[model samples]
Target: MRTSIATVCLSGTLEEKMRACAAAGFDGIEIFEQDLIVSPHSPEEIRGLAAELDLSLDLFQPFRDFEGVTEELLLENLYRAEAKFALMNRLGIDTMLVCSNVATATVDDDDVAASQLRRMGEVAAGYGIRLAYEALAWGKYVNDFEHAQRIVDLADHPNVGTCLDSFHILSRGADPAGIEKIPAEKIFFVQLADAPELSLDVLSWSRHYRVFPGEGAFDLTGFMTHLVRSGYNGPVSLEVFNDVFRQTAEERTAVDAMRSLIWLEERTSVALADHGGAPGNDGGFPAYPMELATLPAVAQPTGFNFAEVKAGDSGAVEELLFQLGLHCEGRHRTKPVQLWSAGGARVIINQQQARGLAPAVSALGLDVQDPLAAASRAVQLKAQPVSRRSQADEAVLQAVSAPDSTEIFLCEATGDGTVAWAEEFGSDGVVEGEPLITHIDHINLSQPWQHFDEAVLFYESTLSLVPRASQEVPSPMGLVRSQVMCSSDGAVRLALNIAPMGLEQPHGGADYPQHVAFACRDVVALARQARQRGLDFLPVPANYYEDLQARFRLGDDMLDVLQSLNLLYDRDEDGEFLHFYTATVGNVFFEVVERRARYDGYGAPNAPVRLASQYQRARSGRRDG
Candidate 1:
């Protein structure tokens, strides 16, 4: 696929944006007119720079409100378009994007609009240029793409055709199946963007909330499938107008944009394969004029092998784990790391090269069917390879770095659920007791505000994990936005959270806590044993029990036991959930959960109370200090 992006999608000077795009491997870019108007370099100079960087100047956009006007206004618009045509000639671009008349359209007659477009097309043809007319979602009379296409057909000029914009079409709930009816040659250009389903006005939503594909709620795979079936082989470009993308680092945003296109191409390819890769009566899936390339296929991770924490002083973390019934199995022979385990759940405490950093959940080990293949696929999708030191005697794990700089190790899945690297730890023997925790239920990772969406696409594309709809949880500071990504069988779950506005800390300090939750058969029994071991539970407020009783109408005995143990309880149509949290040790904490009868939630209803309790405890600790 020929990938392109618009200059308006990034944050930088025009020159910087071009450089970032070229570095990110985009084949071409559509120059937004405002970017050119503000550039110190002339059109010819910009053309030279694009050539020097080995990039193509695909199109110059956004000539707007040129048609559906009176005679005198039509003449004036023609004069204005002629000037842009000369400039496009100078810039070495052959096409211009003319959006449907959103303003200054005195006449709503199709013949008038077509006549004006034909006149403009004559001017464009004189300059050896084409016009890709597009419909705006909020256009005065030409809001629908079909309406714009009808106008293009009436004009019957070789220089005039339609520009298919995914945002413009899908945002209006327009059916894309009609695209196949418009001959492929008349489809001059295509622009792609995905957005979450929002109830706001279309203009507001398109202008500010557009996200990269796979990061939003849009079904872009189906959109691309329809576009490909239309046999339009033009450059598939991105034209997003997002407030967040405009403020982030241009290089990072450009890379994220490229990754989105790569993912979209792969998804579209799979969709085609599912249709038997042949044209049929069902949909007539003809041979694609444009070939879509795919990546190395990988299955979703089977489960989490271990969660690793790094800290300067491991005493607090060690004691906390010990109190939770996880004993230190053994220390690594060559590294300052110890493995703590109880049943299938494992935690790694690494004290190596952690001189000044706060304790944090820094890495995760995932069990994949084939680690090498997974790593290869991740690298092809622009993930940075993470190198860890290991000797010949040690197991060499393939790994990659997530957008948040967390190292993700792709460990080989074992038949008996044993980790190969665990043998490297010189353990005397297994500890004697019934296992308190069975395995890891989930891990919550806090993301930086700017990279939250980027992290979502990263996990979805690289790991093949599916993202659930996001929700907001109220905290003491503000609202916390949380999204969950998990495998199909519910074996691996990652809860990604954007901290409430005022709670984010620089360098990921203890100010914002992240926790690892373990699944236990009986959380009440585990909580009782932890209390006897002097574990400091995150205290629950007295009012929480009263509210719980009111909500669930539990008997007195049940509520009393829950309150005495500082445990939280929740129930749904499926089953019940019992869980409790431990006090924060630096930035890392622990949770023990018992899920009954296929209850597959994270107890989201109790999140507000937990946040309030943690905030109150932190404030009280400050006063005591």
Candidate 2:
């Protein structure tokens, strides 16, 4: 039940990464060896920081290539591990990642590997440290969980156990069922990642393209479910390697990664219901709500909201959503992301990007309660203001691309503050920061072409957000440069960025407006249910994941499940994200995002590829006409 993730799972300097991890609400962190060695802060200082953050140093990882080495090298390795243990003791870290003979193994035999490993485990045990043996996908030996488990078993050392990495497990076609056979106690660590369904070299792909749990094409839910079913409840950590993620800002990356965790929780809940795995001790995560199943046919107004606009001209943007039934509410105290109300539902308008904020869309968010305080804190913390707009009063200021041209309105919700959007909106019925919007689940914004940079800065500077490790889509229907933004606190989100121009093909009645995304409890079940109601649902091609399976040779069950729903998939070391886009509404389209533990992003990697495929699918036959 204790959840954990590796600090290295995130991308940044060790301190930044760990802080981001803690801020993202992780209970534990796995320290990479190099991170500690290269840090300006001492082990004691690092330990103190973690304690201050109430975060546990779950593991001091990656004592690499330890197993199957010569006696001289083994002794040297032990000496190295002993030193790390001393630091771990300083930092209060408990476990270390021990790769079994990845690069420097002299012997290939199991006896040699297990014997060498066992001896090292005792050394670690002496330091009161635990060793988690892991298999690299391209390891010299012991390259899978089953094989690593064999080494742990043959070693006969309680101090040593197998670490289950979803990437290595699924990449080499390792079985999840085997995890159940092993004792949960012996399964020392669980690392997760997701990837596109391809037959590329493992190292290159894992290093460059690995995504979070919900953004790839792997069955992390099944793997974890088996672990859960076996009562192996432990820290299920994410270990990812995507270049884009590394290059992004620390806070933005952390939020997106954490959002994937939320998405994964939802998927695991649904998967357990269908596959009969162990039920979560925590509350269940229902899938994103795509239809009006539980949503009131007519939403009631909560009165806590704001709106935004970067108009090229007069009220063009305002007139659009207003026609969609949103009413002009009052102005925000501070910041630019505007607020609009309809019944109880909230709608935000963004026009900051309309003039030149190409990549970013400054949309309105529901009340954050202390808009003034949040804005002041952002400014004190060096969160920049929107260059174009200005504010007069002490009204709760939502951020207008505070960091990246991504605007946000902080309504008085939970945090202690003097400012609240309620007073400004003049609504008596609405409570402050009342999770009025049950779950954003998802949102899509259209971006202009080759202008992901502007979008990136807009969201980052404007909203203090960052792009998740996925893809920058270049579909003909706008440039689709998505940068998902989330609160410093964890929250669900989906920013479907689009390029300015339309796609090459005809976009006839496309309305590329901002829209909310939702996840349903069950897509197939809901699909059937909606069929009777005359809602037009898009059909998925059976052959999509077919190429995925044939190409990657990953597990089959998850592939079939995704295909049945016409779900789009992409993978990296992080995890797999399953996605499906709906046909256009006005100029808007929505994506139903379902993330497995291996995935977190709303299928960013698959966005461009899927868009390309959709274009091919939609416009393929038009040439003949």
Candidate 3:
């Protein structure tokens, strides 16, 4: 899990990016082709600067669209690759990021792609250079790790190994388990990045929206774990190409990039230990006990306040809450909001005007020490939850609504006093629905482009989230970008996705929703509570449920109940995601998930079904839509 960042991850000239990487504590740099060929900075100058700054040129990327071509073109591409290799040697760099063909490729001809790639490797071998061949998600052919690995295996050139990019591995929905079986030596490099969890044609979004790891919806930790298990001991570098990253100050971007690497290092170390140790190896790399690396980062959340419900007819919703043992707490002085209390949590129901449809979460009333103080800090860092939010009649506070808004209102509300309001919202008998949604786990948001990095910094510098380093999503999900801004201690998390510029335009899946995932204590118990709450949900089908039971050996009738509720579930060797849905509130609907031990995925396996369901609902014009 040692860290390195591609120079392209920074915003400025090659020199500026290098200086930023050095200042941010990165160990190595991946030089982008355009940065090198177009810049006034020569290979010798880059080499000199790297030496002075104590940085390694981890990789030289990307020899593009090289495979699946005629010999004439292959020869031309070979010469170009050789020239770059020679330059890398001058700069003391050893690796190259060779991409599978894009324009000159045809899936019908694997031989051409492989032959061209093999020839390029042969040329690089003479330069003593290692080429990390990779599948571009949208490549005419060779668009995934497994496919690229086949090409690499066919080539059988030690200098030609594949680059395992988390973004590429994940966006294509490649089976991560294969990573553990890849010959460690064939794994030439690792490109790490994260993105907002979205269902789209993968190509357009990856390039423009990628953000640091733990920031987006991708399961980067799982990818890295599989990498280590496969015996990969190479430099795990960052290769992000985001428009937002390009606009920021070089130093800040570098610091942000280093933070992502450090964060990934810590996570990978733990994930490896969690999965059985490397058959003989430490089965892990970054877990190498270091002093500064282990220091604490984010703050632990002080728990939550309630699950909200606002209804045009409060009668049904109110009955549901009461049936679930939730009781009334107090009323909002300035708004038409009322509070419900249950077991140390408070859920607010804003019926003030009954603006739209049924009850959805109105606001998240978090307990902070000083509202004014936090507000001041937020201003300094330019990180407020969202601006121009719906405000109450009172001038003292504000929380405007957005497409997907999670209003964090800090006030004299909590007073840092003991957490109040338990009996009301707590389980009266077995409160409601599937109980998949326990406490507020994390919030999912879609940010406009060019501002994603700015939002990350806001959360990192103000709300106590250390933004993961930036990385790009390979094609199909091409160019989509995102990052996770989690609470210091990992209690509270927010995932921000970089929506394509024309988000309002038509694309396949459901439009990005501002949805929140709830984490439960005992999913079984919560499911029972949901049963009592009159929730309208469909259980997982018998086939899926039966398959889950057989695969995980889960005891009890939990599977049957989940099936009966029309819920969705998939369990991995690590953890499982039990998902269920209800009516939509405009474009987004609530997703209640039950995560077993070590489950950190944002429910990707279950995405197709969810998206299809939303798409169907949109066609019918459902409620709150």
TM-score of 2: 0.56
**Predicted candidate 1 versus true structure: per-residue lDDT over 394-513, tens digit per residue:** 899999999888899999999699888998998857688788799999999988888899999999999999898799999888898999999999999999999865764321353467
For candidate 2, the lDDT comes to 0.60
Q: TM-score, each model?
A: 0.96, 0.56, 0.52
Segments of candidate 2 deviating more than 4 angstroms: 276-444, 447-625
Model 3, CA-based lDDT: 0.64
Q: Report the candidate with higher lDDT, 1 versus 3.
A: 1
lDDT of each: 0.91, 0.60, 0.64
For model 2, residues 276-373, the per-residue Cα lDDT tens digits are 43253334543221110010011111122433334433243444434333455655445344555543445554433355332113455544434555
Ordered by lDDT, highest first, the candidates read 1, 3, 2
Identify the candidate with maximal TM-score. Answer: 1
Error of 1 at 591 (Å): 0.6
Ranking by TM-score: 1, 2, 3
